[model samples]
Target: MSFCTRFAPSPTGPLHLGHAYSALVAHDMARAQGGSFLLRFEDTDLERSKPEYVRQALDDLAWLGITWDAPPLMQSAHLGIYNQSVEGLTSRGLTYPCRCSRKDIAAALAAPQEGAPHAVYPQTCKTRSMVERGAGDAVRLHMDRALNQASAGLGFIEDGPLHCGVHPIDPAALLDEIGDIVIGRKDIQTAAYFLASAIDDMRQNITHVVRGVDLFEFTQVQILLLDLLGHTPPRYHHHDLIRDDDGKRLAKRDDARAISVYRKDGASPDDIRLMIGL
Candidate 1:
């Protein structure tokens, strides 16, 4: 099969060095393999996503000599598709309504024996019937069933420059660790990151996923979703994240480290590649 990969970045903030490294790595990987490179805007977070940031992200990638096969895929335009997927999953009894708020989950986790990644759902509403799911309910995947589905002989081969190799997932570990992640927020009709991302990758025919190591744990969750949705799982390459001098992973709030700031400082695209050790 032909190799395909994508560089998907949210337009919530200006493209930073971390974004550059990710895009370049994905672009280079596809080019090296004589494959296709796709650019997708992960702007599912409608509240914070801005058109200006989207434009700047495209411009920044262009300046770095990255090119996509077609016009970039924008998530905002595909809300209906995500909604349909959500409906399908819900119909399959693979998702449930979550009434617990973040604060509620946090409070539950604070009690002894709660856990480290604090605030995991205590399944407060897990046993609630579908008829009870109301307008205020958020949709969450049924991790137990999803894991059984994904664990049935699932694996993939990853290809990329920064960190490349085959990575296999244990379905049991996925269920135990990732437990019933939210797919759609009741407050917003748009799909969550995990759902939108998995659907987008399959819909776009992406054969490889190149992203930061910070999201490595979430891969199993995505894998489970793909399996549940009957979509093929793609190869994955989780690269090292760019960090500040203090070793903290870069965030959108770090304006000082934004790529626009680096450009203004006369830093070349090559300079960025070297800075990130690409």
Candidate 2:
């Protein structure tokens, strides 16, 4: 199959050096394989996503010689598709309406339970009646129920620089750790990152997924959802992240590390590559 990958960035903040490293890695991988590269704007956070950030991202990518096959896909305009997927999961009894607020979840997780390594949402609203799914209630996947329904082992091939191997998906760990993750946040009127990105990958026929190592754990959740949705999961490449002098991962909020700022400082695209160790 032709190699296909994407560099998806949320426009909530400026594109920083970390973003540059990821985009260039994905871009170079696609070029090496003579495949397709896609640019996708993960602007699900409507309130924070800015048009100027989108433009800046495009300009930076162009300066680095990162091109795409077509116009960018914006998640904001594709709400219906994500909503339809949410409805499908709900109809199968794999999802439940969550009425608990952040504070409620935090309180529930304040005390760790025995045999559970980490605290997760107590599933306070998992058993709630679907009829109670109101205008403001978020939709969460019943992880246990979904896994049982799947009735098979889930795994993904990793070809990245770090931890490269076929990683098995542990449903038990997901249930205990990431229990009942929200799929559709009614409050925001947008699907969660995991749900939307997974759906979009399948929709775009992505053959390879290239992203930061920080997202390695979340890949299992996406693989679970993809299998439940009957879509073939793609091969993954979780590259090393760019960090600062203190060995902290770069954040989009760090304007000093923003690609635009570097461009303004007479930093060429080649300089960016060198700085990022490309």
The TM-score leader among the candidates is: 2
**Candidate 2 regions with alpha-carbon error over 4 angstroms:** 111-119
Clashing residue pairs for model 2: none
Structural similarity to truth (TM-score) of each candidate: 0.92, 0.95
In lDDT terms, how accurate is model 2? 0.89
What tens digits encode model 2's per-residue C-alpha lDDT throughout 47-88? 889999999899999999999998999999999899889889
* C-alpha positional error of residue 216 in candidate 2 after TM-score superposition, expressed in Å: 0.4
Indicate the TM-score of model 1. 0.92
Ten residues in sequence with the least summed lDDT for candidate 1? 155-164
Candidate with top lDDT is 2
Query: Tens-digit lDDT track for model 1 on 74-117?
Result: 99899999989888887877788889888888877776776664
Instruction: Please give the RMSD to the true structure for each candidate, in Å.
Output: 2.0, 1.8
Off by over 4 Å in 1: 113-119, 160-167
